[model samples]
Target: MPLPEKEAWPALIALCIGFFMILLDQTIVAVSTPALQTDMGASYNEVIWVTSVYLLTFAVPLLVTGRLGDKYGPKKVYAVGMIVFTLSSLACGLAPDMLTLIIARGVQGLGAALLTPQTMATINRIFSFERRGAALGVWGSTAGLASLAGPILGGIITENWGWQWVFYINVPIGVICVLAVLKYVPNFPPHTRPLDPLSIILSVCAVFFLVFAFQEGEDAGWAPWIWIMMAGSVVLFAWFVYQQRRAERAGNDPLVPLAIFRIKNFSLGNICIVAMGFTVAGTPLPIMMYFQQVHDMNPMHAGLMMVPQALMAFVLSPYVGKLVDRSKPGKLAAAGFATTSVSIVLLAITMMFDLGLVSALVAMTLLGIGNSFVWAPNSTSTMRDLPHQYMGAGSGVFNTTRQLGSVIGAAAIGAVMQVRLSAGDPGHAFGQALLLAAAVLLVGVVASMMADDGTRDPS
Candidate 1:
């Protein structure tokens, strides 16, 4: 049964709580990196793994988790994921050492993987097609707001209470989400389908190697083993793709539907989202470090720097959502990418040149504005045209690319900073790292430009 208008909003609100928490964890650790390093007596590489491992676990299982939503009921899977997340969060808050925290975070990521797809898939199932753009706009905006808000919130919590509170805070939010979901969110009929284990193994191994190679490359002196691992990741991923095609043809339920890529907007949107993910994930660590470590700002002050970007996104997302339904999403996305890339470039220049806090604030404000344009339009355009049968699969693929971009960004930026740190200038090293994210955003610009721009009427 389709959800009535009155019921849908409540359900979406309930779902967004869980969704927000998932995205929140993605970058929340950024502001706490220094704290974690000091408290746990860990090196930079190990501290970076705290974020990377979460992203790695989160990304690898997403393809299957979406299928789990299709096979089981979304509601059941979502509820279970929430339980896992809440408990792991508790474990994270109490961890005795860095290794324990990283392990707990990996479990937390698994819960995130299970929870993410159901929100999108449920929104698709419940809302009428005419209203999906607006619903998804709200969804997309929640994603943007959560991601951008992470550093701000993390700083505040870490500074006042302790870094442990960052994870501890999720406990209450998770409990509320699980309860609300059980009360408000309805379960759709399940599609009983078989999953391929080989494909799952291949994908997990492929991503693990690729990210691991990047994470360790600089410290390992770009060793032959790193290059070999990189090559092996490519081979494994290529094999995984080949197997997916064969599975689809053989009537064995494939992890991702290859036919979905034929939707030009969907494919292009995925590419753009990858860049979006990459930039968002890649920038936070270096930027946060610059503010606190180099500039001698307290954690609270460092977090306050993100306020402009968060405010702009919060204020502008509703209007952008409307625009996405009424205007050319492709153009909006292109403009957004161009604007974001410029903002990052400005930030990089400011840091590299010691241009001061005012310049950085201006860049952050611009970044928020740019985010408001990208998140809603890109997500709406990408999934709006997908067939109902592929809704779960489509959501899975979309999120996978987004998170995969994050994983890559996290590793690549860390590596870049590690290498550049040898130059003996903290500002220069971090600023150079920011440029990589800026460069990647331009790919989003080009992808958005090439995308189909046909607007769909709300009626």
Candidate 2:
């Protein structure tokens, strides 16, 4: 049965607020680096760690956290996560040194890992197939808005209120989320699967090693050690997969149940998310650098240009949501990825030649419009067919895949940008970087074309 709208919509709203804040943390710190370095007397490398460590820690536990929601209740885990996140945010804001800030930020990441999966799982659990597209649309819109808003908000807060405000901003929002969660969010039935600690440990290490190698590879001059670690990550992950499958056959609870992948859309959906993550994490580097370094725009001005992108997402998403409810998600998702791909390619072409800022804005707005279609539909397609009991496992895998994609994308794009910069003109390098990102996005289009089995909403 569909949830009573009275209860469902309010809970989604509360959850979105917290979800928005958590995702915002991904990009917000980029604008605050200078302020933080000067204030804390941290070396440049240490300041970089402030962001990197957070990313590393945030990505590590997602698979486990998703299952945690299943074993416990979503409301309980979500409530606890908020408290941990809020207190850590407080610690981050008041930190005496870089060391303290990084530690607090890592803790914040842990809280985030706990909180992320419940969002999708809860949406999947509460909404019916016909209605799920709309709920996911809101979730997708929040994500789109957060990506654009993080930079703008960060610039404003960092300039006027100091860097601490970025962390401090989470405090009131967190408190409100906790209270809203308690008041509105339902307690989902527990999955009752025994916790799999070995799988959890392996998954965490696999993610951590892969991310560490990719993020630090170029910085460390692509050293042998990084390669070895990367190889070790792959081997460890292979073993983890083997163990999960063996556990499944043995009737033991696996960290990430392989059965979740038996659903068609869910499997392909993951491939698309990883590709999107590459572009989402990849796009801003060249554009932001082009804005500030090429055009000499300040951080705030550079950030303002992204507003049009978010504007498109905000305006177009409701209609897209309706379409997602009615149409085959594969078609909408394919179109979205295609449009997004074209937008980025055009942006690279126009920017590489220094065509005009107006052209770049137009391109990004189109990209944002395309962004409107991709997230919700893919999310809907992935989780809609899964059994209710599997929502936590499904949500965790989905989100973890997305998070891992983001980490990989950031590292890959950074390496490519550095290589291109060393070889030729900055503008040309930026364009090449974006071209690579667009190619990655195109992979999503191809994967999406093969999604949505025509089982729920017909083609």
Candidate 3:
């Protein structure tokens, strides 16, 4: 049965809460890293793992979870994930050592992997196309707001209460979300074929090796092991492709349909999405460190500084979504990328000059606007052309690439910063990193330009 209008809103609210919780965890731990190190007596590498392990698990399982949601039901998968995440949060709060904390974080990532893509799929399933853009705008804005809030909230908790409160706080909010979902979220079972366990294992292995190489390569120093893992990743990915082709030939349901890429807009749009993820994911960590550690800004002040960007994104995304419904997405995406590139260049310059708070805020505001323009519209355009049959797989693939981009961004940017700091010029090192991010964004613009304008759905 189609949900009543009143019922739909609560379902969306539950989904958004889950979405906010997952995104908030990504950065909240960042500001608390120093505190964690101090409290746990951790080495630098161990401290970094507190964040990296979560991201690692989060990225790897997204494809699997996305498919699971489609095969079972988004509501079931999402509710289970929420319960696991809430429990894991409590575990994280009570963790006795770095090892325990890192393990709990990995479990949290598993829960997040289960939760994240369902948000998009549910929004897509429930809302009409005409209204999906707006729904997505709200969804995108929530994530941006969470990211913006994390550092400040984390800082305050770390300062007054304790870093443990960061995880502890999730318990009550998560309980409310669970209750809301159980009461309001409707279950929709799969109308598709059975799941492919072999494909799932192969794909997971492929992504794991690839991300593991990237995550550990710089730290382990271009060693033979890293090279072997990288090579192994490539081969495993090729095998995955071959297996999918085999499944298609055999008329079996592959975990991911190869034919989805036949949709020209989706294929190219995912490339741009990955690039967008790289740009946003790579910039924040070092920038946060620069603000708090180098410049001596308080956590609240640093978090508040990000407000302009988050606020601008929250304000502009809905309008951009409206524009996506009426306009050619390529031009908008290209324009957004161009604006983002310029903002990154301006950020790099400002950082190089060691600019003050107001100037930095202006730079961030520009970045936020640019980000808002591309983020939702790109997603809408990519999925717009897809038939509803493939929404699950397509959403999975899109999110997978996005998460992959974030993983690469974090590893690459972190490696650069690590290398540069070792050379005794951390400030200039970050400036160079921003320059690289700008170049990446420019590539995203090119990809956006190449996207299929003709495929856009003219509602």
Candidate 4:
């Protein structure tokens, strides 16, 4: 049965609310890491582990959980994720020590991984390609906006109530989101696929190795063992791929279906999002650090430096959404990412001078304009030709790559900053780190240019 337009839009709103909560959690912790260190008497590394573990847990199980959404229904899977996430958020808020906080954060990551894939899959299952562009525009903008708002919200909450309030805040929001999903989101018939335990094990080990190696490499001094671990990660990932192929040939369900890779735009889209993921999650750290560490601004003021970018994204999103629905997505996405890379370069240039705060606003506003274009278009176009039956798996793979990229970005930028800070001025180091993200986003721009909406027929 066709859903009434009124009901359909409401469903999207509820899902977006849930989606916003999860993303907000991802970036919120970054701003509050300093507060956690002071409150808990923890070392720098231990405080960072709080954030790293969350990314690890959130990212490692995405492939499996995404398929879980298909085997069960998205509504059921999403509800369970919300419950787990909400409980874990409470645990995070009440923790008396750093260890307990890290443990609770790991649990929170599991809930996040379970829920993340369902959002894109839900949108894919509900909207047609023509309309999906607009739906995805709202969805994508929420992600950029939530991330941009995280530091601001975190700074305010941490300043007013304490760092615990940052986690505590999620408690009510999560509960409300659960109720919203239950009331507004419709449940669809579930698909049945026999789970392959071996594939699961292989994939888990591969992700753990890669994410841990990247995340801990700098902290570990890029030791010989770290290099070995990187090599092992590559080998394990290849083996995982081989195992999936074998399972598929044996007529068993593979963790990742090989068929989805045959879709050109889908393939390109996955790669491109990885690049943007690096930029989106990686770029803010330097800006915040430069403001607080070098310029001596308060946390709240540091966060406000990003307002122009988020505001621009908000203002331009509606128009960009219409463009995605009306025009060629490749050109739009390519142009958007390209514009962002230029902004990043400008940010880097401004970092060389003491005029970071004044100059960065211009760059950030320009970056926001670019985000309005690429974020939604890439999201919609990549899945445009995906078969409905594989929505869960396909969306899962795309998100998994993105999250993997995000964790790596966080790790890589952290390493870059550490090195630059040791070698030169703190302000210059901050700006240098921004350049790495710009380089990555430029790669994404190239990938986006190749992601033609009509290049492949619908499966």
Candidate 5:
């Protein structure tokens, strides 16, 4: 039966609110890193891990969380996640030492992993086909807005109040979301499937080792241990693939079905998503750091600097979403990548010349517009043709890939900055890093062109 329109909207809003909290935390913590360092007396590398650890936990669990939501219920899992996230935020705010804060951040990431996948899954279940695009457009915009707002909000809180408030702010919002979920969201029972414990263990180990290696490798001087971890990751991944295939052939439930990749468009679109993730997610923090630390801009000013990008994305996303619904999403995505590449090049030039605020604003606006086009269409295209039953698992895998890309992007960009700055050319190194990100987006353009048009089954 179709949901009553009023009934669905509340739940959707609740889910988006929860999502906003998660997205907000990503950039908010970034802008406040300096404040955190001073307050906690943390080392530069330790400060970086404050952000990295959250992402690491968040990225790895997405695959399983989505499937868990499907097998259980999105409402139950999502609400539980919110409660945990809210409590964790409190713990983070009250943390007395760096170790406590890091652990709290990790807990928050775990909550986020549980919460995020269910938002899309819930939207898919409630919204009709005709409205899905519009709904997703709103969803996409919320994320963009949060991304834009996080830095500024973080800056404001840190500058005026203190860094602790960054975590504390989530409390009220989290409470509201939790109450809203309890009041409106409906719960459904689980789908009967055997849990793939081995697959889960192997996948988690592989991702943890791989991400840890990448994140610490540069700072740790690419030690022998890092290489060992990387090699272990590869072997574990191979074992996971083999295990999943075995499970599938034996007529048992696998954690992730290997056959999902058989669909050329889905596979190809995911590559674009991963590349897009790398290009955007990782670039912002280092750029923000450069603006604040090197340029000596205050937190508020640095945050305000990003306003143009946020505004552009907010204004353009609805139109872009509509375009994707009616036209070829791949073409739109390709155009987005092209625009992004051009914008990055412009940014590189601006950095080389030490451009003023106006120039930087224009560059960021262009980047934002490009981002709106890429994010909405790429997401829509990736999931467009999947069977309804697979939406949960698909959403999980899709988000997991994106998060993994984010982790890799952060590490890669950070390493580049570290190398370049150490060599006494911070500006030049930043430009090189931007160029590398642009190259990644250009590759996304190629992958987007190859994505399926949803004319065939995704599975």
Candidate 6:
């Protein structure tokens, strides 16, 4: 029984409430890190763990959690995750010490991991094919808008209500989201097949090692242990792949179906998102720093500079989503990537030349426009043709790549900033870093060009 579009919208709104919070937390804590250190009297390394630990826990369990959504119903899994995230957010608010806060954040990350894939998986199952792009466009907009709002909200909340409120804010949102989901979201049947424990183990360990290496590599100065972890992750991942192949040969379902990659759009979509994650996570810090460090803006003022970017993305996403259903998604996505790349170049120029805030605002407006074109189209094209049985796994793989891209982007951009800052003025250093982000978007452009049109016959 396919859900009616009216009902599906409510479910999607419910799912996106949690979705928005998950992404918001990912970046919300960035501006609060310094405040945390001061209040808790924690060392710089300890404060860094506040964010790093969350990413570590969040990135590691995605494969398992995605499968869990398939095994138990997504509704049940989502409810559990909401409870965990809400409780952990409370714990985070009340923590008397940095250690407790870090632990709580890790639990929150685990909760985030559990909630993420089910949204996409559920949408795929619920919506008729013809309208999926519009649904996803809304989802994509939620994702992009939440990210842009994080720093702004963090700055406002941390300054006015204190840093703890950042965590406290999620409690109400989480509660409402959970109730809405249980009421509106359909109870989709679970896949009752037993999961292979070894596959779960290998996937978890492999992702943990890989994510941790990148998360801490720059901080650890690329030490031998980091390199060892990276190598070990590769080897374990290879073994996991081999195991999945063996499972397929034995007629058993694997954690991630090996066949999903055969879909050209799916493969290309993963490639494009990795680049998108890299650009989204990597580009912001330098520009934010340029605003604060070079122009002497406060955190609030610096965060406010992103208004044009957020506004454009929010305004244009729905229309662009309609276009995805009507046009070649690949071409649309490629145009988006190109537009974003050009915007980054413009931002870089604005920074390097000290071209003032007007030009920078112009660049951001273009960026928002580019983002509007990318998310809905790229995601719709990627998963539109995926099989029902594989929806959870596909969503998991899709999300995993995006998160991995974030980890990679954060590490890479940090390194670039470090090297550039040491060699030149803040303007030049930040400008060069923006250039790297611009360069990475070109890869997305190339990948998007290879995607399918994403059109499907009416169900």
Candidate 6, poorest ten consecutive residues by summed lDDT:
450-459
lDDT string, candidate 1, 1-459, tens digits = 458999998999999999999878766776787887898899887887897778777887887888788878888999999999999999999999888998998999899989999898888778876676677778767876886688778877887889899899999999999999999998778776687778778877887787678667767888999999999999998998999988877767787878889989889999999999898778887988899888998767777788888888877887887777678788898999999999999999988899999999999999999988898788877877777678788888888888778778877898889889987899999999999999999999998888877744222
State the lDDT of candidate 2 residue by residue for 1-459, as single tens digits.
457878899999989988999989877878898888998888989998998888887788888888888889888888888899999999999999888999999999899989889988888766767888898888888887787789888988998999999999999999999999999998866766576677888988988888888878878998999999999999999999888987777766898878778888889999999988888877887888988888899888988888888888877777787788888888888888999999999999887898899898899889898899898877877788888777787888888888878887877777888888899788888888888878888889999999854856321
Q: Model 3: how far is 292 from its true place, Å?
A: 4.0
- For 72-167, candidate 3 gives per-residue lDDT tens digits of 888888889999999999999999998999999999989988888788877777766666676677777887788777877888888998889899
How close is every model to the real structure, measured as TM-score?
0.91, 0.97, 0.94, 0.95, 0.94, 0.97
Q: Of the candidates numbered 1 and 2, which has the greater TM-score value?
A: 2
lDDT of each: 0.85, 0.85, 0.82, 0.84, 0.82, 0.89
Q: Per-residue alpha-carbon lDDT of model 6 for 160-271, expressed as tens digits?
A: 9999999999999999999999999999788877777778999999999999998879878999999999999999999999999887777666998888899888999999
Clashing pairs in 6: none
Q: Give the clash total for candidate 4.
A: 0
Residue-level lDDT tens digits of model 4 in 264-326: 888999988899878877777788788788878887787888888888887778678777888
Instruction: State model 5's lDDT.
Output: 0.82
TM-score of 5: 0.94
Task: Put the candidates in lDDT order, highest first.
Answer: 6, 2, 1, 4, 3, 5
* Candidate 2 global lDDT: 0.85
Q: Please name the candidate that would achieve the greatest lDDT relative to the true structure.
A: 6
User: Against the hidden true structure, what lDDT does model 6 obtain?
Assistant: 0.89
Better of 2 and 6 by lDDT: 6
Q: Write the per-residue lDDT of candidate 5 for residues 74-189, one digit (tens) a residue.
A: 88899889989999999999999999999999999999999898988877777665455566777878878897788778878988989999999999999999999888888766
Every candidate's CA RMSD:
2.6, 1.8, 2.2, 1.8, 2.1, 1.5
